[model samples]
Target: MSDLIELRDRMRAFTEERDWAQFHDPKSLILALVGEVGELAELFQWLPADSAAARVQDEPLRSRVGEEMADVLLYLVRLADVLEIDLGDAAMRKLSGSASRFPPDDVRGQAPEKA
Candidate 1:
């Protein structure tokens, strides 16, 4: 697997090949990320909570979820790359911020929460 730096470059080149940089400004990237997440959620439309919970067990459903997840993360990582942000540093800072909001000791075996 490639490191984030290599992956960022790879993604950049891939986008550049299609002249997509103009469409990937920060605001648009953020919107695209949200839209992809909405698409992911749409997969569970009209399903009961229990059925939604079971969706991950279905391989095809998992693939759809994975696709959306990858889209979200791709935009995020690319946004950071474009903004000259260090992925590791940014992540550590975010995790450090979370430390105050959610103590590691307190979070063990508990459900994750939105930050």
Candidate 2:
């Protein structure tokens, strides 16, 4: 199986072991995912763009950033798993849609449209 599948299975087992599935409904998971993403963003807050990239190469900062990133990914994977969504497939489908919407020739070097 793919590593993401294995990781999702492991997360499922872990949550089941804790009887936490009751707390993992889609809305709650989305909130938790947002919280994790906020934590991850905090690491880069106020840094110049180049400095932010360089910060990840340092010691304690690197480790902390890695932990926050993992938290973000873990929450996202768990959210997808709870919702019975196939993340890899969804990503591929989204990428295909994006490619059609933002044809390279038209969008090359252009800023993304605001949501």
Candidate 3:
């Protein structure tokens, strides 16, 4: 979709602006993703799931979560881009795999692995 390409282009622009193309090679991009995930975790630390839901609307906290999420997605999108992956195709493949792994007729209310 256009949105995906737009995001890819925007991310490229960011790296270009900082002359960070060399540093953003796959290895470092993967590492940066892990760091950003940690930042997301830090924001939710010690919060109960129910309480955590509220943070989604808390401006400052939500901003941190949003940034971290975007960071992860940007790297993932770029990685897929580099690998010539059709993301929509990949997502559909995974969804089909999950459907086989978890048939809706019996998956509901089942325990984690048992599902």
Which stretches in model 1 have alpha-carbon errors above 4 Å? 45-47, 50-53, 104-114
Provide the lowest-lDDT 10-residue window in model 3.
Answer: 106-115
Candidate ranking under lDDT, highest first, comes to 2, 1, 3
Model 3, span 1-115: residue lDDT tens: 5778888788778878998887867778778778888888888888888889886788887887888898788888776666677776788898898889887777777864842
Best by TM-score: 2
C-alpha RMSD for every candidate: 2.9, 1.4, 2.3
Candidate 2 lDDT tens digits, 1-115: 9888998999999999999999999999999889988988988888789778887899898999899899888889999998899998898899898898888999899987941
lDDT, residue 104, candidate 2 = 92
- C-alpha lDDT of candidate 1 relative to the true structure: 0.84
Model 3 lDDT on a 0 to 1 scale:
0.79
On TM-score, the stronger of 2 and 3 is 2
Model 3 superposed RMSD (Cα): 2.3
Q: What is the lDDT of residue 38 in candidate 2?
A: 93
